[model samples]
Target: MKTELLEFENKHKLLEPTSTERVATLEAISEYTENFLGNIDTLPAFVNNVSEKAPFIQSINFEEQNTLNEVLKNIRLYIDTPGINPASGGHLGYIPGGGLFYGAVGDYLACITNRYAGVRFASPGAVLLEETVLNWMANLFGYSKNYGGTLTSGGSIANLTAIATARDAINLKAKDYHKAVIYTTQYAHHCLQKSIRILGMDDVQWREIECNNLYQMNVEELEKAINKDLNNGFLPWLLVASAGTTDVGAIDPLQQLSEISKKYNLWFHVDAAYGGFFILTNKGKQLLKGIEQADSIVADPHKGLFIPYGLGAVLIKNKKLLHKTHQYLANYMQDASTEKVDLSPADLSPELSRHFRALRLWLPLKIHGEKPFENYLNEKMQLATYCYQQLSNLPDVEVFNKPELSVFAFRFLHKELPLDKYNEKIQKAVMNDGRVFISSTRLNNCYVLRIAILSFRTHLSTIETALTVLDKSKKIAEDELYQELRNN
Candidate 1:
């Protein structure tokens, strides 16, 4: 039996690579990534290579081993080359987060070390690193030392965890889920609503409060709704406000909403996934007043800090509530249990096994310090203002409202064509142009193009190029539509 086992082990020895193999693989990856970064500005922000005829093969087979070179080539051709190039600065459509090179370096080191960051007993340094990052965010938001939070995959997951904590803290079982109420504005990210349903509170009285012309939630409407809900014997347990909404970057009246939450005794959760870090600036601090008062807040380092697309954080003022909501107990985890060790990530998050996400964010925060990020955020806000101004000045263009942070919406007004179809045509045209990517959304039953300026690489030149592209794309769209109508 021993001899047979030895033979099997020998056959599978390829699983463990030698020093030479490791170096070669690392070198290849480094070269490929460096080249990709060097040429990122030249790449299209959005490209659709998969037509009906040539979709990606669904089956991923490891039946045959491929060389490193072949694998890298295939990755470049099939994966990175198609779809939205998120790393590109021209990605102004969604909240763009330019993947910082320092972040990439940190990711490399984290992956190589493979630290068990989920628990302190396994890797104290790694766990502390994560806690330190969370603490930094807490300090930014004015959360006290009594508070705790967790590093999550992104805004979606971060919101999920925070919602779950709120759910548990309320101590309402499934029976009460149907009667509970949640109040939020229309601009709140869909992820929050999804989290509500996922938590078995689908039947909760989810109210979409009215918004003003700028798309910010109306405080009067919110107060009336809450009071009405209370009068009607409904449980108004949660109040959600966006620091920077996704569509138009409209920040709800946080200070006003916080006061209402206090009066009604509700949990206030601020979704600052895109605009949280802006507090590093003086204007941002003024705009985000009362954010420190949130019971819990969600922020994405990816969007606000330009540290790639996978880091999100949640800060809760009540540490005990967060711990009670997420902490699990089992004999297997006895070794990790202690009053001292932590209160670590496993106790405060939904994840049992977590990637070393803190390193990626921490390295950049350390290398560049906070001043650069503050300046970058201020720059993005200025860029958004510039874009709004430029687009508004164009003939026959409609600007929605003044940008509150670093995003705004506008659409081309075509006299001859139906506005909806014309704007959709323009969206397609801009996407096809591939020089810059833009997205459109329906605002009050009207189609409008939305631009979120957050990419660190997006500078004055990028905005100028995008303005030119938009002009050309609109003309091309106009001609194409006019020709089609004439043919018809």
Candidate 2:
């Protein structure tokens, strides 16, 4: 059998890459992709037995393209097309573009090269790449030459670092500290609260200021809270202002907050995680007024620039602030005497073995001029406004918080319906149908539906479809109520 196989191989000469084979391969792949994409209109449900076993590779020899195709097809089916609504909104899932392609290639190159981004001594190029991005981010926020920040995993970690910096700044100034307070709006992301808790400050004061009708941080309330804390002899360590709140996309009055921070000598940090980079847009720059005055700012490219997830930034107006918090020398890590301006990723944040994530953002900015992002942000703001208008006109649905950025909240309202039970059922109804996905929130005693139009793929049609889903859900609820009344 071995001799026969060897003879056959010699005679066939191992099937060189001929035009016929190439065309056949191309056609096979084209058919598979066409089938997957073309069938998206139907969004058909897929069924696969969990216990099914794939054939062994040895059994297939060389021509296993059919088996590979089946695997790809099955995986594609498992992805659940159109994607799920990120607790935020508008799944905008897996967009393919130059930015995404380059980011993938960068990751591939980094993997092939295996550059360790943690230590400057080991991989100065990788560290420099990360630092160049950080410097770019610092400059983008209008920070001074002295200001700097580190790329972080996401908002939670960014917030943690910002608060840690604030803590270190306070600790340096004060000799004895009995109480520490953190001030932020009630609408501030949960990450701030999480950061405060994680810092091991059991007596840490949380001045959760209320929001105004526009869902922005109430400056008057903020002032009152700060004064009360001061009067009570509690140290106000940090004032965290939300550049864009998670639920309603509200940008707190940063200018006012900054003033309060200055007057009170509080560490000013802006959680711009969701909407910071919108700074490129005329409206965003206008809306995020005084964000530059912040001592530190957190931004997420994944949210605004539409880069794939796992990238967030914390920009400090004073680079010393990061050193105040993170300046520690391990025998192997930092050589303080040399003054290496090139940033080692580990020196900036807690993580040591960090991925070269900055290239995902840096390459995109260099490839597409910043103006494109500005234009895209403007379009997103318009889409949010469009969605708000659509939701507002519907009789049963009430547009609760006017969107300050790209996120807005709405809820079904009726005299007879129980809010909790009714909203729960409506949420399920929308999800079960699966044409579009949205999320819910409880705002001011009512269950609210949140629509965040922040994704790069979100367009007019997607907004229209989402509104259609809302309208249908509302009508279904109303019709059911009428039927119940008639039966009763």
Which stretches in model 2 have alpha-carbon errors above 4 Å?
A: 1-74, 77-99, 172-178, 334-343, 478-488
Indicate the worst ten consecutive residues by lDDT in candidate 1: 50-59
For model 1, the superposed segments whose C-alpha errors exceed 4 Å read: 51-59
lDDT tens per residue, model 2, 361-460: 7777788767878888898889888888877886767788777778888777788877666776676556655655666777887777787767565578
Q: Per-residue lDDT for 1-488 in model 1, tens only?
A: 99999999998998989999999998999999988988988988888775443223334666777788877786787788777888988888878866998998899899989999988989989999998999899999988999889999899999998888888888978888777999998889999989987887788889999999988889899889988988998999999999999998888999999999999999999999988989999999999999999999999999999998789999888999989888788888888886543587989998888899999999999999989999998998899899889889888999897888989988899878888878888888888888778888889889999888888888888899888888888888888888988999
What is candidate 2's local distance difference test score?
A: 0.72
Error of 1 at 209 (Å): 0.7
- The best candidate by TM-score is 1
lDDT, candidate 2, residue 423?
71
C-alpha TM-scores of all predictions: 0.97, 0.81
User: lDDT (CA) for every model shown?
Assistant: 0.88, 0.72
Relative to the true structure, candidate 2 reaches a TM of 0.81
